[model samples]
Target: MSQISEEEKQYVVFRLGSEVFGIDINKVKEIIVYQEPTHMPGSSEFIEGIINLRGHVIPIFSLRKKFNFPEAGDMGKTRIIVVEAGNSTVGIVVDGVSEVVMISGSVIEKPSSLLTSTVDENYITGVAKMESGLVIILDLEKVIGRDMAEAI
Candidate 1:
């Protein structure tokens, strides 16, 4: 039981197009319904803009656009997952949030070279082999860090 618990990690699963991705649950703050953000002029293309959440203005980025996926129009199922990336708080827009699942570390595998070449490998932590399908675990810090660095 101890061994199982040690190997199990909780992830917040979300969808982008048909692909599923996950982030460490501990990094997530909250999930909110899709809301149009106030447009910020001269921001990055991937940035949807900023929204005031409980008095704190949080910038929202579209994972689909960042990943170069085609724009999906299913706004009803869309969600914004607020997460802590490095020292700052940011929100990532996903197609939809599925569930929080506990996956065993033993079943997590290093991402393949093909996948790495397609998408910046730095963003990928690992790929979890689930009974339904694979869930790519993302390092949001690495993914958002580059953009933040560029802005600075």
Candidate 2:
């Protein structure tokens, strides 16, 4: 059987366009300034390409494209949030990364089924209610998908 903990969870918040989203802090490796990735032929459209981070070649994907957000204008605010999912590490491009915040798990509510029509509900673990606004918590595994994660 599985158990649920009431412990507070930390998340790294980021902006895609006008919307703000959050990812589990444990999955995040690091956040770096945006850099143009080398284009790879015949790869997925969302896959911006790859970059050599330190010594490792990491594939970078556009979270805006994946989420159907408009292309970013200012590169200055852009950032690449490198995250470790499963056995591979991938970088996700975001408009900007805000401060990390801790919130009790009890404050997270399961996403409504209606959201499935606009977004793949599987990608969203839950919705966190914050004083500022609602923060959509992303399930990195589901957001990247098993096939893509394996390919990375």
Candidate 3:
């Protein structure tokens, strides 16, 4: 029998309000500054709709609206963190992208009670303590599960 090897993953960290959130780095394709998204009528409000990304019409998602955060107007450092969700590639608008961080499967921990009240802890992989404070590791698949659901 062959021994199962753990897969390594990288994460791209970005900020929502003051809190830091990280998504699978592999999901990220590129990051762009804020640009108005062409609205898709009848689509879910969370989806900011498609944008012309390098001649490819890629949909954009507002993470703030996704997590139910109060609307923040005109961020000086807003960026679109491009992510590929399943078959389609999409860009997610975030406040900004911090440096990429590493986390091994062995070090990943379950979300604590603190995140539960804030948002579903299941959406969080674990809490990473940093000298700056704490960074909440996010589960992109669970959070963006709605996209595929809507397609059906």
Candidate 4:
């Protein structure tokens, strides 16, 4: 297989609240419409629950709850972004799924100290400057840490 260079990377953008975030397109498996997942007792608060997708059980996580944002009431635009990180396949709930875009490495900047402190510093890989506005790039593995990844 041919390797894709860092500069040629593409991202799947999604919105959590008013803020926008992006994940490497390579890590995204698929995007699915919102569905209520079966609640699992003793699971993390951020994790909505588990859902059976094509016979495979997948854990569903809520970005809003994880980021401590106010609960969202609208489900019309909500989407479950199924992403593959390592050997685990999980889904993250986002307010909406935005368009995919290619962002050159040169236009990506390290997360500012202010941004890192406000948002979770651990998950942010960088900030990409787009014509519309800035988009935060997230590292999937970091967002769902090793422990959580393995557990779910």
- Off by more than 4 A, model 3: 1-9, 104-108
Q: Once model 3 is optimally superposed onto the true structure by TM-score, how far is the C-alpha of residue 48 displaced, in angstroms?
A: 1.2
- Relative to the true structure, candidate 3 has a C-alpha RMSD (angstroms) of 4.4
lDDT of 4 by residue, 92-143 (tens): 9999998999888877887766876557877888888789998988988888
**Candidate 3: residue 26 Cα off by (Å):** 1.4
Report the Cα RMSD per candidate.
Answer: 3.6, 2.9, 4.4, 4.3
Cα lDDT of model 1 by residue, 35-99, tens digit: 99988888888788889999999888878878788889768899999998877788899989999
Model 2 Cα lDDT, one tens digit per residue, 1-152: 12225679899999877788999999999999999999988788888999999999989987777877778888899999999877789999998998899977777777887744456788888888899898888999888866465445
* lDDT (10s digit) by residue, model 3, range 21-132: 8787878888888888888887777788878977988778777887788887768889998877766677788888888877555544567675556677767877665556
Model 2 alpha-carbon miss at residue 71, Å: 1.2
- Give candidate 2's error at residue 15 in angstroms: 0.6
lDDT of 2 at 65: 76
Per-residue lDDT for 52 in model 3?
Answer: 94
Candidate 4 lDDT for residue 51:
95
After aligning candidate 4 to the native by TM-score, how far in Å is the CA of 39 from where it should be? Answer: 0.3
lDDT of each: 0.84, 0.84, 0.74, 0.84
TM-score of 4: 0.91
